[model samples]
Target: MIRVLVADDQAAVRDGFAALVDAQQTMYVVGRAATGRESVDLARRTSPDVILMDIRMPKLDGIEATRIICTDPALQRTRVLVLTTFDLDEYVYAALRAGASGFLLKDTPRAELLHAVEVIAGGEALLAPSITRRLIAEFASRRDPQHPSPQLAELTDRERDILLLVARGLSNAEIAGRLVISPLTAKSHVRNILRKLDCHDRAGLVALAYENGLISPGDQP
Candidate 1:
């Protein structure tokens, strides 16, 4: 079963989400929190597989809570899915930087929300190609080209190419077809890149691609 925790300052939204998740036979809500700090505490206690976190909360913010949970060695298996009001906005990006596995808009369809939880729980980051492009565009101009991450040196030519494909929002199957390799090979390369860069998921890789100057704003995917 996929263990989940719901965190939002609003009681109605929090309870509603918990109810929705509990309705699924494949998943269950382990806890609910009205504040970010409570979310963090509950997470340590429950050790849930996924957390649906609101970006804004009292006593602390979801982004900071996500950071704290993700960085904790004991909670390494926990993945955070940020809830936002906008698509591909600054808050979502900040949450991703803080090690969130993915994000969804607050008004996302119920089916999609459940699917997103499953995907992140299964260790895949949910970033559609279109959303990835917009995320890159949203922060391209503000990127500090002069201070690229030194971790770029850890990747080889093939890995660099793969990273660019990931930044373009290509799936492992798509990348395999594009590069004339098996899907498993593509998946392996992606995993290697994630390990080399110390990233939590594909979302982090997309962020790193831009932050390390691999993919720039206005660059065609």
Candidate 2:
């Protein structure tokens, strides 16, 4: 079963999210916490497959908690899926950098919430397409397009091409279709890109691609 720990300062949110997850046959709630510190403690004690973390919490914020848990060697297998408000793009990027596997809006549909947990537990990062373009653009603005990215030299021509598509927010299957390669081949290439780039997940690579001017806002695959 996919074990999950819900961490939100609000009781109603914790209970609601836990219920939704429990309704799923393949996933279960292992614990719940109302504060980020408690979440960190429970995460270490429970070692759940996924932690549903809220960005704002008492004592410690979810971003710090995620960072702590992610840096812990014992919790390496654990993935953190941050819960946040739609306008909190700042927190979203910060959490991803803190080693969170992904983030979901607080008002996400129940089905999507369950699916997100499963995705994170299964060792994949996910982002809502609604926020992706804005996110890329936000970082893209800070990027010095004229200087060129130093990290670009680390990739082969094909790898660089793959990174560009990834920045466009295409899935592995999508990438495969675009590149005329098998899905597994596309996924493998993505994994290699992440490893070679030393990124925590696709989220980091996406930001890196835009921050390095590899992919521009509204670019198609």
Candidate 3:
């Protein structure tokens, strides 16, 4: 079973999400929290596989709580999936940087929400291509394109090419089709890149790609 924790300041929404998750045969809600701090506490206690976290909460905000939980060595297996009211929420990037695997709008269709939880639980980050482009463009505007992460030098030419596609929001299967490689090969490359760079998931690769100037605003996929 995939253990999950739902964290939201609103009781109704929290309960609704918990119910939806519990209905899934492959998933179960381990706990519910109404505040960011409580979510972190529950996360540590439950060691859930995935957390549906609200961005705005009492006592602590989701970003800070995500950072706390994600940075904790004991919670290393936990992945946070942020919940926001808007697709283009300003705080979403910060949550990703704080170690969240991905995010979803609160109004996301029930099926999509459930699928997102499963995706995160399976160790993949979730960001729609459109959202990825717009969000990265908006945030990358403030950053210098010349700034680069030294660790990027460790990547091979093929790995660099794959990383660029990943930052453009291509999934393993899509990347395989585009590069004429097997899906397994694409997945293996991604896993190696994550390990070499110390990233939590694909979302971290996107963030790293931008932060390290691998791709910049207005770059074509």
lDDT of each: 0.86, 0.81, 0.86
lDDT of 1 at 132: 50
lDDT by residue for model 1 over 1-221, one digit each (tens)? 99999999999999999999999999999999999999999999999999999998999999899899988989989999988888868877888878888778889899989998988898854455466556655775577778877788889999999999988778888889999999999999999998898887788888877776777666664
* Stretches of candidate 2 exceeding 4 Å from the true structure: 143-149
Q: Give me the runs in candidate 3 sitting further than 4 Å from their true place.
A: 216-221
Better of 1 and 2 by TM-score: 1
Cα lDDT, model 2, residue 24: 87
RMSD, one per candidate, in order: 1.9, 2.4, 2.1
Worst 10 residues of 2 by lDDT: 124-133
Top-down lDDT ranking: 3, 1, 2
**Candidate 2 structure quality by residue, lDDT tens digits, 1-221:** 99999999999989999998898899899999999999999988999999999998989998899899987889988988888887447877778777777677888888888888777787743556447556656746765778765667889889988888887778888889999999899989988887788676777778777777777777765
Worst 10 residues of 1 by lDDT: 124-133
Note the residue pairs that clash in candidate 3: none
Best by TM-score: 1
| Model 3, residue 66: C-alpha shift (Å) | 1.3
